[model samples]
Target: MKRLPLEGIRVADLTMVWAGPFATKILAEMGAEVIKVESPQAWDLVRTLIPMPGVEEFWNCSYYFNDYNRDKKSVTLHLADPRGRELFLRLVERSDVVIENYRADVLDKLGLGYEVLRERKRDIILVSMAGFGKTGPEREYVGYGPIIEQMAGLASLTGYGDDGVPYKTGISYGDPVAGAAAAGAVALALIRRQRTGEGAFIDLAQREVMATLIGEAFVRASLRGEVPPHRGNRDERYAPQGVYRCFGEDRWVAISVRSDEEWRRLAQAIGRPDLASLTLPERKARHDELDRAIEAWTEQIRPQVAAQVLQAVGVPAAPVIDTEAIHDDPNLVAREFWVTLPHPRMKPWRQPRSPWRLAEANPTPRRHAPLFGEHNTEILGGLLGLSQEEIAELEAAGIVGRAPVDARPGG
Candidate 1:
């Protein structure tokens, strides 16, 4: 097998829930040794967030936790405990990166701030991903992905024009966006350290990352004193662009006519050659009428067929596939977009492959997510050279263990 880009790098991962875990997962896929640290008394909330009713060891069997946390080692540590903090510092001495997504004040309050980590390892890269950055007025505020989107102005631009209300995304949109950015940030920090031989403290604000996604709105707000109006699926630059209902219940297809030529093709494809001669301005003016016309043709056809027919005629179109249907999508399947990895606690289920495709050194999932504290002995004893007697004492003291102490959802 070819060596991956991140091979030989070791990361001390303190991230929990979605964003931090998502970032570390990407690093792990690229062959980094990611040691996921959790406290026996205070484990990652996602572990038991959605408990399996009849399952034993519910924390070890959460599909949500397992899916995002694959290809990493889990180590239990109570950072508040003096001995646990000392052991964590020892681990950091051998690590390349340390990352977390706690609220801005949490890490510093725990006394493991960047300055303290720098004291232990001079060239260690520390990444802090708070919903708001560490030094801002909003730093004290706590939030999850949905709240981040609303505060970032995305939800403001999401609702249908007819409705006087904003809408959140179907998923936790901000989490993965921040996660991808954090991965890139870690890579850049590593590159900088290689040249300058100095570590970096990356304070990544999730709300700021979310705002970067809709930069054009900020430009409009500044240059013209305008706020982006909610237009649903309609684009300001393209006419006759909308998601139309198709033949089946709750099925839809998105179509966009970028140019007058594409509009002409779309018009002719739906047997409206008279409308085909319309210019961009005319199409823009009659967008509602054009949507009705397009829907009339699409209502009788399946979404996939409508998309195919329009795409064949040189019009931009695709079916709006739902969550379950996306796993079986023909195009995605052809591209080998999913992989089924073996998990000890559960049956093999198809999970998404990384979208970052490096043609030469292709990355693949190496292992299932580690069970809680699965690597305590391997990491503490093998890496830190702690004696077996010391390891047993730590386990007895609740500094390291396989199961969270009194673990419960949202506790």
Candidate 2:
């Protein structure tokens, strides 16, 4: 295999939940050695977010945790303990990057801030992904992805115009967006270190990253003093654009007419040839009536069939695939976008391949997410040159463990 871009890089991952794990996963895909450090007393919450009923080691078997955490090693360490902190700093002395998404105060409180890390390894890159940045007034506030969306103004732009209400996206939209940005930031930081031999402190605010998505909305508010009105799925540039229900239960197809020519084609495709000559203004005026007519035709066909017929006539259309149907999507299947890796505790299931396709390097997932403390010996003994007796002593003292200290049903 060709050498991946981040080959030979070592990262100490001090993140949990979606955003941090998602960022580390991208780095791991690019060939970084990501050691996920979790304290035995306080492990990643996602491990037990949806525990499998009556299953042994349910934390290790969580599909939610396994999906985002593949291609990384797990190391249990109680950072609050002096020995664990010493070991972590020793690990940091040999690592290229240290990343965490704790609140702005947590790292300093743990005595592992960038200044302390730089003392151990002067050229180490520290990427802090706090919900708000370290210097902001809101830096002390805690926030998740949904809260980030609302604070970033994304929620304000996401409702139907008629409802006078705002809606957050169905998924935790801010998380992956910030994760992708943080991964890119890490790459850039590495490049800077190579060029200037200087370390960097990247203070990334997740809310700021989410706000970047609505740049046009900010421009409108600033330049025209206009708040962006919600149009739901409708685009201002396109008329008669909406997602309509199809024949199957809960199945829908999204259709858009960008031009008069496409509108003509769409009208003909929907068997409303009489409406083909309507101009853009006329179409805009009658979008509701057109939607009703389009639905009258669409409700008789399956979403896929409706998408195909409309697409055949050059009107932009696609089926709004739900969670289950997405796994069977033909386009994704043809592109080999999913892979099913063997897991020790769970049956093989399709997981998404890295979307960052490097034609030559061909990054692929090498292993499943590690079981708790799976790499404690490999890292502490093999890398740090600790003796077996020393490791056993640490484990006995509750500085490291094979499982959480007080495991419960819900994490």
Candidate 3:
């Protein structure tokens, strides 16, 4: 086995919810020691968002929380308390990176902003992933992924053409995109620090990162007076491109005709060779008719079969794998895209392995997410050199603990 890229690095992860946790998840996957710190009074909401019916340790049993937070240690602390603040500063002194996704002003208000962390560790890198950046006029506005999509112009570009209404994605799309960028930003900051010997403050706005995904839309708006009208699943450049229904209930296959050659192959595969000679303009104008014809053929076969048949004939086609089916997908299974990790509170279930394929390092999930504050003793007493007696005092003061002090199960 080879050494991971971040073997010796330690991250003080003050991130909660998806975006920050997702970023730290990647960092941990790359072999960084990520210490996930949450306040006892304000623990991660995902822990209780979908609790098991009668599980006593509901906070520690959430699959949603465990999936994203695996391979990291948890430590409870109340930053508002003077003792907790001093303890966090001590942790920072020994950490290489500090990351958070609080609202823009929250860190500053807590008086543990970038400069304070830099003071503790001169080469500390602080990555702040606010909904909006720290210095912007909209910095105070609080938002999650859906709001980010709407504000970033993605929702406007995503609807059925006839409705003229915007649509949000089914998932929290903004969170993962921003998280991936934040992880990359950490590496970039680390690289810069190697040459400059200085700390960096990374202000990553979720909305800005989401907007970058549609840069071509902005170019069209500026260069050609084009406000992209929603085309649903249809692409502007491709003529015969849409998701067609297959035999099973709600089963569908997405097919795209990038060139006339692909269109000919698709038409031949569907037993409509007469339609193969149609030009791109003709195909675009008669897209509805073509879709009906395609669906007529597809509705008799399974989505996977339809996709495989089309793909065998040199057509770009794939089944629209639903949430449940995606896990069992043959392609994904072949690539080993999922792994099952042992959880103390929950049964071992398959979770997504990191998409990052570092052929050399080949990162793997090492451990389940820590029980809330499971590492309080190891981190404070072992790493910080605090005596066991001193740790007991902090735990007694509600500055550190195993479970959240104000935990409200299923709230």
**Which digits, one per residue and each the tens of the lDDT, describe model 3 over residues 168-284?**
999989999999999999999999999999889999999999999999999999999899999999988997999999998999999999999999999999999999999999999
TM-scores, all candidates, are: 0.96, 0.98, 0.97
What's the distance in Å from true for residue 176, model 2?
0.4
Candidate 3 segments exceeding 4 Å error: none
Residue 357 in model 3: lDDT: 76
Supply candidate 2's per-residue lDDT for 124.
Answer: 98
Provide the clashing-pair count of each candidate structure: 0, 0, 0
Number of the predicted model whose lDDT against the real structure is largest: 2
Model 2 lDDT per residue over 236-325, tens place: 889999999999899999999999999989888889999999998998899899999999999999999999998888889999999899
Cα RMSD for candidate 3?
1.3
State the lDDT of candidate 1 residue by residue for 264-341, as single tens digits.
899999988889899988988999999999999999999999999999989999999988999999889999998998
Clashes of 2: 0
TM-score top scorer:
2
lDDT of 1: 0.92
